[model samples]
Target: MKKAYISLLLVLVLFSCTKTNKKVDITIPKLTNNPSWDVVCTNRKPLLSFYISRGGIGKRTYIVNLDTEPEFNSPNFIEYKNIEELDKFIVQKRVEKPLVDKIRYYFRAKAIDSEGNESKWGYTRFSLDTDYNKNFMNLTRAKVQNVRVSTGENPKNLIDYDDPGQVSFWQAAPPGPIKPWAIFDLGKPTIISRIWMLANINRDNGWLVDFVWEKSLDGKNFEEIIDAKILNNDTFRNVIDITPVSARYLRLKINHFRGVAPHLNCVIFYTPGKPKVPTPPRGRYVLLVGDQMNGGTFTQLAPYIETLDLDLKTLTVPHYEISLDMLNSILII
Candidate 1:
């Protein structure tokens, strides 16, 4: 027993020495203020993986983030105690499929290290996998916004979407109804999650706006998704949160305006919130339009957008035209 214990101790000492010799020690590498990054998706969700893998040996990790806005932005300088918790692998996780859209996105990639340092190789410009089996579907979709609306001089009751008179494609607004214009031909039914309204168009430095939003699957019968109203809110065009509401049509009902600078710079629609069903893989989400069915009207959503998107950017290729087999199929060939 005594001989065996001695032998074990000798072996342990040798193992420790071997480990020490093999370790490639590194001091906290001075972060060169430069940031390197790559984007990847395991489940179709995009993750910005940042890094400062500059002249390093082994892959050491750290933690980072914007302290001001925790929820909006995630920490890039992050380290994981548990490797399992680390979303280190770049996966194309289509856990929640993106909403149907015409505009699309490709791919991006990033990297990070032990020190809270970042390198910038960001936002499009990722290497592709040529291997067929390992290839990823590298594209995104969004409706191209084309319908432009300016204020008019008269106030009309836009509360009635059922009436064709309610909306007039405006070049300019009248003195009344507060130049209400919004583009929501987002293709598929949206569970609107974010609303960014910017009343920053007036050059005169002051503006007041009262706004309400309504939505409907069948454009004729619209209802307010969020009853929250902005009464003379002096906002200089900012992002607002519109909760998850399932609808295809959205109306930005604006009434009672004052002050100046009432221009909408942009309204960016974010990904929908937690949906009812597990989102499918990121692919083409098709919606059939054209209710002109055999002298019958099915009352589909207004502003059939797909046709517009295709029409505006139709390629002069040899592909056959989209026929009855596309939108509304028929008993006849």
Candidate 2:
């Protein structure tokens, strides 16, 4: 029609002279800054060490577990094209939530990009205490024999398991050290929630004798409750939780059984959920035995111990730091 309108106006003037100059837009910045980074040790377990600012290039890092709220893609969190990939994405930012020696868990992390826009949520503010295996309930018994502390000096009260009277795994020492003690039974009334002792000294080094434990819910009124410190003998593993207390005959009264002799092997107990209780019971249970633990284990690892005697019930002296200050005042960090 007129040379087709001058060949479409010379192809729109060579595509506007090759987009005239230039304007690029891929879009990848919306992590709205927040983690300026500088929280080394929130004391014991709140780790959130950050500081990845070459700003204007971060790619993605959106890990959200806030308690299994789930969503962790993790492409090494794709820091981006330099600084060794944000130093391998800040040595791979970690987000592990598992703690319950008496119930403790808190988490929060956000740093999104790929064009979704995020980054305001940041918290590694301590809440993973580790070792309260479901508020510890049910199991009633975890047998690990090796008792006979007779009377060295750990008992000023309840010692009745069919009349255990004035319980005493007692230990004052210097008389005939055969100290190795252990006794267990919770087969049914467990409201307990913590008591773990796993040690490993290797190399015959002796001098271990630390105790102090007393508990009973029917075995005849006992109540001393943990006192002999200084243990962690070497391979380490010592956890005690009795904050809930509703036991049913668990006695270990050797309050001062030192190393090099007071040899106990291992002892563990943490019950509160899923030991399988729904068949003929009302609720809360774990007595039959066999499911050692597999239903809400924030952290359960054991090895060696030589005289654990734990009745669990301790809180004072960083005793879970007031539940980590109520999980850092309800996550504001």
Point to the candidate with the largest TM-score: 1
Model 1, runs deviating above 4 Å: 1-171, 177-179, 201-208, 260-262, 273-333
Quote the lDDT for 32 in model 2.
Answer: 20
Model 2 C-alpha lDDT per residue in residues 112-197, reported as the tens digit of each score: 54454444554432223333232333433333222333443432221221112212223234535454344465555666566665
Judge candidate 1 at residue 190 and give its lDDT.
Answer: 62
Question: Residue 28 of model 2: what lDDT?
Answer: 28
RMSD per prediction, one decimal? 18.9, 22.0
Total clashing pairs for each candidate: 62, 50
lDDT of 1 by residue, 1-333 (tens): 999999999999999999756634333322222222111123222233332233334464433221112232433222222111134332121213322222223222233434433334323212122232243112111232333243543222211112232232122344544555553655678666655443333232324367777777765687875644567664455455555667666666656455432334334344442212212223333333233311112443333433555433111111112233322332221
Q: lDDT for model 1, please.
A: 0.38
In order, the Cα lDDT scores of the candidates are 0.38, 0.39
